[model samples]
Target chain A: MENIALLMHGFAIAFSLENMAAAIFGAVAGLIIGAMPGLGGITGVSLLLPLTFGMNPTTAIIALAGLYYSTMYGGAFSAILLNIPGDSPAIVTSLDGYKLTQKGLPGKALNASTVSSFIGGTIGIIILTISGPLLAEAGLAFGAPELALLVLFALTSIGWLLGDDIPAGLLATAIGLMFATIGVDPALGQTRFSFGQINLLSGVSFIPLVVGFFGFSQVIDMIISGEDGAVATKVRIRDCVPTGKEIKMMLPVSIREGIIGTFVGVMPGAGATTSAFLSYIIEKRINKHRDEIGTGSMIGVAAPESSNNAAAAGAFAPLLTLGIPGGATTAVLLGGLMMWGLQPGPLLFTEQPDFVWSLIASMYIGNVICLILAFICIPILVRAISVSKKVLVPIIIAVCVIASYANSNAMFDVVLMLICGILGYLMKLADVPTTPMLLTFVLAPMLEQYVRQSFDMTRGNPSIFFRGGICWFFIVLILLVSFSPLIKNFYLKMKDKKAN
Target chain B: MGYVLPGLSVLMGLYWAVKAFGYRLWVLNGPGGGLFPLIAGILAIIFGVVMIMRRYRTKKKSDFSVKSIFPVVSVIGIIIASYIIGLIPSLGVFIIAWMVFYEKEPWLKSTAVGIGTALVFYLVFDLWLAVPLPMGLFELI
Candidate 1:
């Protein structure tokens, strides 16, 4: 009941004029950015983050959060119309979405995707509203050791799950950790790796690093991939309306996937992409019209679309409650929270109820706003998908330079951004996933602080890390995640031997 | 690219480990500044070694070409030009050049986009955000 009262208060905050405008602007911008190929939530947020430098923290977060989930709605635009996924999560959507386009039912696919995104996003927000505070309350019991173990669990899981090559992922994780150690040491206040440069004193800036990694590397990719303009397909708004039976068929699937996606989002390392893939696989197995899944079925469009949006919402649970980012986009948002000087953790709920609750409350509004904007702007958005990559490539490069410079008004940061961008491109060329690196970069400093605190508490007793149930629980999970690859290989070999 | 990346990782691990040792690894039983970096360095070395070994066993042919470095070179040119002219002007020139020369767009349209984008950026970053973007030779003038 008290939580409900707080939620009402949150609604009041979200209803404020500034916040309302932020949400609307974010929705429009997110839709356009999401509809563009090769740009995802991470790049979109990184580009827009600098614009919010002077805004109130709550308003800034509200705007970014609005942008984050609306991308899920917008991503379906390109996938349904042009056969190119606007984002990674929407790759599954394109399988049936483009097939539907081929069958002259692009309108139906778009409508199904939009409706399912809304349903899944709404359900996810409800779960977050219920679970966020509960999770925060539970987190209050954790000590330094448990916190350290939990961070380690998150890092190891990300390293294990992000790429096909485990060694490559581990290398990325190590590199991120090493990067975090560049500035003054968190514990002893001793500078570790400054190499005498003054800019190195404060460490590498997050904005420049992120802009370089996600934005600038993308520019490089666009330039290299060569330009191909999407052929515009006309779909009138009237053509976008779905039948009652179609809505009914999508509703149950959306609800089920939404529920599942929320839980998946709450888990460390598993993100919207995973959630969407899992939902589609499950839908393939169980749907009444299973055979029609890849044959332009509405259920195919709904299943992944709904789950990805739900997972986007679900990702916030861990981020708000435990200060742990569930995925790469949330990791970037976590960095934003820190940049805003708002510490995200259990205390965030008690310390800043207005901030936490308002952000949560805004999600519901953002979902509705996204849905309406998606429907009304379909014609324009389809055109946006056709915008020339030649034009986009140069504009993104300029934005990257400006964003990196705007961070601290230093040209050095711009140079750093370029370096990181090149590095990011090289990493991609080597098939090394950069997501774990970004996640680790954000979490490594926090892990250092917790580990040091634990060591200080126990006078460097290694046993301190194994003291409590929470610590042990995290330890067990970390070990299991770390060795699961080996276990799987062994099991596969045994099965093959048996078959022989 | 495959061999280069793992080899770079190995070298970086070596450098990091040596630099980390300069800081005390421990202070009175508690971890000092060097401990975490040392751990990271060691992990990097282990992972890099494994990656290199796997690459060696596979002996996969590298598909890398010098062509991919063109974007990097172009951006570096822009950075150098930014120092000579200004960030806004250099970016405007980059847009015009890329569109006109690379995309083969009409001069009128490319110029309009170039100047228009630069103008918007100036208004936002300078007038609104007050970011004090680099003026370069403009500052000297």
Candidate 2:
């Protein structure tokens, strides 16, 4: 009953004229950006961050968060139409989606993707609404020792998850933690890492790092990879709206994926990449028409698309409850939360229940607004595909430069972006996934502070780590990931011998 | 590209390691300031070495081509030129001009498009939103 009152308050916050308009704008923009290959909700939100400096924080947050779901829907259109995914989640849609397009079921694939995204996204929101505070309550009971272990566990798990190559990811994370310490030490007044540079004293800004790493570097890579105008491909499935008969066929699978995806999304370390893979696997193993799994079936597009969005929304669970970021986009969203002057943690529910409730309420309205605008703009956005990439790249670069400069009007940021962009481009050339860098960028500060704080509390006694089984659990997890290379190599060799 | 790129990352890593050492290790009762970055620097260098070795061990194909330099260099050159001009609008003007010339659009059409785009952006970002933009030669506005 109390939840009902809070939800009503949430509706009041979301239904406002200004908030509604922003949500609609975000929904449209999210899909547009998401449709572009190699860009996703993260890129869209990052691109729009500069524009949010002036608006009310709640308004800005509402709009940006809306982009996450809208992009999920928009990305499906691209996958089905162009056979290219805007992000990890949309990859599966491309398999059956493009095949469906060749068979002229582009309309069904696109429609299925949108409806499934809507279903998955909404269910994920419901879970967030009800379960967020419940978890936050449990998280508050956790002491400093628990948090210290959690951060380490996350870093170690992510390190091992990137492959048997734990060093590179850990090194990247260490750099991030070091970078986090650059500013005036909160504990002590002494500037530790500044090395006499004025800008260093303030610590590196999150804006430049995010923009350079994701945005500017993206442009550079796009240029390098021969911008094929791949994004401009339009979805022209004959029926822009789904037929009643088609809806009936796709309803069960879409709903099931939405449920499965929401649960997958909530779990830590289970990102969209794995979620989509599992959804495809599940669809094949359980579907009534299993043989139709890969050959342009509507279920193929529905399952993964549903799961990915659910996961994206579910990715919010850990971050909101425990203040732990679950993915790259969520990490940037953390930056947004900070920019809004609100921290995501256990105390948020106690201290600012209104803010918490209102944000959740906004998602409901935001998702609906996204659906309406995306439905309307499908034709115009698809027509944009005909625009030549040779013409588009220059225009995009100009906008990016202006946007980066506008964020703070700082020349240093522009220079910083160029350097990072070059390095980002180089990293891409080297085959080191940029995903780890983003995760590192998120975890760096928390890792440093928690380790220091825990160490101090323990008075140099490493036993503080073992006081709770929590730390041991994470340590075990990391060990498993660390030894994964040997296991993976053995498995491969066994398969090779069998083939011979 | 292989040796030079990884070699450069290693060099940067070494530089950071030296800088990290300049900060005292473990402030009293606290983790030393260099704790995170020094570790990071060393790891980055190690990873760079691994990448360099793997590049050779696998004899992997290079997706990069030499012609890629033209787009990068030209875009960078334009950015530098804009800084030299010390005018945001002039930079905007030059961007459209470069596009026209590089793409071989007619000068008249290019100038017209440049002027129109500059005005729209100036009005949208500056006049309406009132964002402070560099005025350069047209400081009167």
Candidate 3:
């Protein structure tokens, strides 16, 4: 009942003119940004984040959070029309979505995707509303050891889950952790790795690093690859709506996939791309049209689209409740939160219930707006996919420059952004997973502080980590996640032997 | 490129580790500032060395191309110019040059793009947001 009342109050706040405008603007921008090939939710959010500065904290987050989810809706446009994924999560959508378009059912494919995306997003938000506070309550009981363990668990799990190459993932994480240690020690107040630069005292700013990693690096990729416009497709708005028969067939499948995606999304390290693929695989096995999944089937378009949107929502639970980003986009959102001087954890729920709930309320409103806007603007968005690289690259660089410099009014940050951009390009070329690195960079300082705090409480005995059940649970989970690939290989060997 | 990147990480890690070891490793009944960095450096060294060794064992194809370096060079050029001539003017120069020389767009269209982008930046950041942009030589504008 209290939750209901608070949520109602949140809606009232979210309904304000400024907040509503922010949400609608974010939805429109996110769709346009997400529909652009090579620009994903993370890049879009990082590049546009500067616009939210100097705004109310609630309004800023509402806009960003809206962008975060609406991008899932926007990504479908290019994935279906051009056979080019707008983002990583949309890769699966392009598989069957394009095939459907090729079969002259572009309308059906687009309709399925948009509807599924909306249902999935809506379902994910509902689950987030119920589970977010519960998780926060659990987090509120955590101590220093628990926090340390949880951060460790997140880092290890992300490293294990995100990339195919485990060593590269760990290496990336180690580098990020090293970078996190570059400033004045949070505990001891001693400068460690500044190398005698005055700006180094405060540590590497998140904006420049993020903008470089997700934003500028793509510009380099586009330049290097000489990639150009996506293939164009035509579809009338009147024909984009699914037939009643198609809708009836899709409703249950989308809901099931959406729920599955929500659960997968709630799990740390299982991101939207994974959820979409998992839903596709599960739908392939269970649906009556299993054989027809990849061959222009409606189930193909509906399941993954819904699942990815749900996973995006599910991702917010860990970020909001535990202060750990569920994926790369949420990691950027976490940075935005920090930039606004807001920390997202259990205290965010208690100390700023209005902000938390309003952001949630905006998600509900934003996703609906995203659906309507995406539906109405499909023609424009499809044409938008063909934006020439020559034009887009220069504009992107200009934005990167403004975004880097505008935040702190510092030229030093622009230089830092360039350096990080080079590093990001190199890392990309090396096939090293960047997400683990980014998450580690964000979480490392918090982990170090917690570990030091726990040690202080225990008089330097490491056994303190083992005493708490929650701490032990996380430690064991980390061990399992880190070694799971090896464990899985071993299990496969055993199963093979048994079969022989 | 693969070996050089990881090799650089190794060298950096060793340097950081050596420098951090000189600090108090433990203080105030807890792990000191140096401890985490020291740990991170050690991890970096170990993994970075492994990456380099693997590079030697497996021959990976280089994706680096000479054409790609041009964009990077141009971006660096723009950055240097911006520092000397302010951001908006530098951006105009970059946009015009990139479009006309590299992309081979018409000089007229390229100039339009250049001026249009500068105007948008000026209006958004300078006029509306009231951010004090560095005008450099273009301060008179």
Instruction: Give each prediction's DockQ, rounded to 2 decimals.
Output: 0.51, 0.37, 0.48
Q: Comparing to the true complex, what docking class would candidate 1 get?
A: medium
Clashing pairs in 1: none
TM-score comparison, 1 vs 2, better candidate: 1
What TM-score goes with each of the models? 0.69, 0.67, 0.69
Could you say which candidate leads in DockQ?
1
- Give the TM-score (0 to 1) of chain B in model 3: 0.89
For each candidate, what is the lDDT? Answer: 0.80, 0.66, 0.78
Best by lDDT: 1
Task: Please give me the total number of clashing residue pairs in predicted model 2.
Answer: 3
lDDT by residue for model 1 (A197-306), tens: 78878887776776676667755665665534223344455766888999999999999999988876776556787678667767875789888887789999999999
Q: Sort the predicted structures by DockQ, highest score first.
A: 1, 3, 2
User: What DockQ does predicted model 1 obtain?
Assistant: 0.51
Q: Mind sharing the TM-score for model 1? A: 0.69
lDDT of 3 at A66: 85
